[model samples]
Target: MRYLIYICFLISFTINSQESIDAALINSTDIKIDQIVALDNFETFYYLQDNILYKQNKDGTSINYSNYQLGEMSTANAFNSLKINLFYQDFNLVIILDNRLAEIFKIDFNTAQPYKNVSYVSTGFDNTLWVFNIDFQQLELYDYKTNKTRFSAIPVQSIVLSLESDYNYCWLLTENYLYQYNYFGSMISKIENTGFTQISKSNGHLILKKEDTLYFKHKKKEDILPINLPKLLINQFLLTNETLYIYDLEKLHKYQLKIN
Candidate 1:
């Protein structure tokens, strides 16, 4: 009787542990996408396909915008409803688009002297841009209208992997560390990297992907929880609030996270 009780306890513990870590696959849909830009809401998302930017609404309606001269879009940052910065690394230009998928303006980085080698760009506060100066290995807040750098951080030591920002803060992900900076270009916080390749932020929580595993943590907390994904050949994934969207080249999987 004692042995049976112990066995049952072990099995129950294992089951509970797995349940705590795993994400529940709520639904999945067929999707062909090269990259995902924004999860505007639970049902709507924006993606890139064949050099064209598309906004897929909740009701399966899609509105697309494209600029043939811009070449392929390298990255896009939808900082707010009013501003979306789309960077074309090959063309050395950044195109500003509104929420309705209308092109507002384009900034040719080639004309921005002394900071020509811009590898990445993100939307900053008050019509400014957070750009990674690849030539100088520094992060700069550039004003397109004035054609001047409003603020510049010291050269980073590691190779920058990605850049993200909102109206109040900017986050830089390097090969060695994750850095958070204020709008004034002052480093506010730094977290040591634990072999993460990609990151996404929503509602004060940070989601990181390293290898095939996903991890989640709060902005001010140190505890990291491993989020288990359903078995699939994942190309990339994104987290919006408590929902996780996994893209496997051909289909997009949606999971509802209940990590405790």
Candidate 2:
């Protein structure tokens, strides 16, 4: 009996150790960060949709122009310093904004046979965009810099809620489920939760908000903890460093949490 009890303790400790997030802050003071322009890392910044990218710092700022516009943004692979956006006027365009959210290049679809009537729409991922031609009838992947199809596949017609990309994973959210894909556009995993309304990733953890409650899951843990949240409906959330920033309507709320 004693042996069995000892074994059980080991297992539980291992599980707890493996499934935790180190909450760095909680209920921190809320600061009114303005213009926002664009926010990336501790340095690069962008504001207003313009041809210029802004180099930002705690004490200084500067701007440089790119040939294209930043459509969608990717914050995960920070080293790539890439931004993806779509534009279609005379041609189907997919623009890549640099890490600094400045300087741009585009992929032109007007010259391609398969690209006729194609429009580039942005998913939530930075450096990633969704290519749909003819009213969501066809969907494909558009890489920002190469301005080419990284992979092409048909999307199930549904109301999409959000999209995001990490260095190795791409996440797509619909009303009923969350589908995770690899950089090559292959399906990796799917989680079904009809109550899911919005999601955000910071650092390496995923924070999902359903109804009025916020839930945090670190890696593959099958359990969820009900975290306290405000009365406002979350417009969006961003996980930066170890801080959780919740955007409600026009205001932003910051929370500190320990994952472990």
Candidate 3:
């Protein structure tokens, strides 16, 4: 009996001494974080408002140039090279913007059904644009070429709430599920967990929030590592390089990670 007690004590000590693991923090020099962009006294009014995409320069002024909610203002490709916007009033309006937030081009939806529902919008690689239509309970992709719209076949049945696209893949979050779709709109994999308030991707990994817990996962991992967070309501999250920017609807916080 005494021997068994001694062995158990040693085991407990070993377990307690083990180090916790987290995502590796890239070097600060290697991971340059831009200054925090603060837009004061701007409240989001529309439940389904267009992207008031603006760029904050080194001086912290966001040069604004949206059509003043003239139409359904959809996706904001702020990080993309072209920074395009998908606008549809009665027809699909693709508005191109420069870095200064100036309007460049406006392409009207020229189809038999000019007034189709654009549920979601995102940018694609090779200067392509992704248009998500939610008509007849289906999601279709429309690739915008230089001056024309080509219908692509990427079907969706779930209700997409927010979406983001990159050169190779796309990340979409519905009411209760999160999906990773390729550029062609084919579902690669999906995770069904509710209360996913916001998501951001960088360096092939994604950072999301479920309730008050912040979770991080790589591209192919099936499980997520929960990060330590206080009891504060988080409305959105943005991950860049290795830093996680948390927006709590009232303030922003920065987190540095250390993987062991």
Best by lDDT: 1
lDDT of 1 by residue, 54-95 (tens): 888888888888888767788877746577788899989998
Q: Sort by TM-score, best first.
A: 1, 3, 2
Ranking by lDDT: 1, 3, 2
* Comparison by TM-score, 2 against 3, better one: 3
* Model 2 residue 129 lDDT score: 60
Weakest ten-residue segment in model 3 by summed lDDT = 40-49
Candidate 3 Cα misplacement greater than 4 A, ranges: 1-53, 69-75, 86-92, 110-115, 146-155, 194-197
Candidate 1: minimum summed lDDT over ten consecutive residues — where? 14-23
List, in order, the clash count of every candidate structure: 0, 18, 2
Evaluate all candidate structures by whole-model CA lDDT and list the values in order. 0.81, 0.56, 0.57
For residues 1-260, could you state the per-residue lDDT of candidate 2 as single tens digits?
Answer: 99999999998897675543333334433434322333456635443233333445656656444444434332212324455342444444545556555536555666654454553354435555655555454446666455566776556566666655556665666776677666677877778866877666654467787877677866556565556555665655666655676655466566777655
**Candidate 3 backbone overlaps, count:** 2
> Could you give candidate 3's per-residue lDDT for residues 79-142 as a string of tens digits?
4535546454444567766655577666555542444556566766665666666665444455
Model 1: CA > 4 A from native: 1-22
Supply the TM-score for candidate 2: 0.66
For model 1, the local distance difference test gives: 0.81
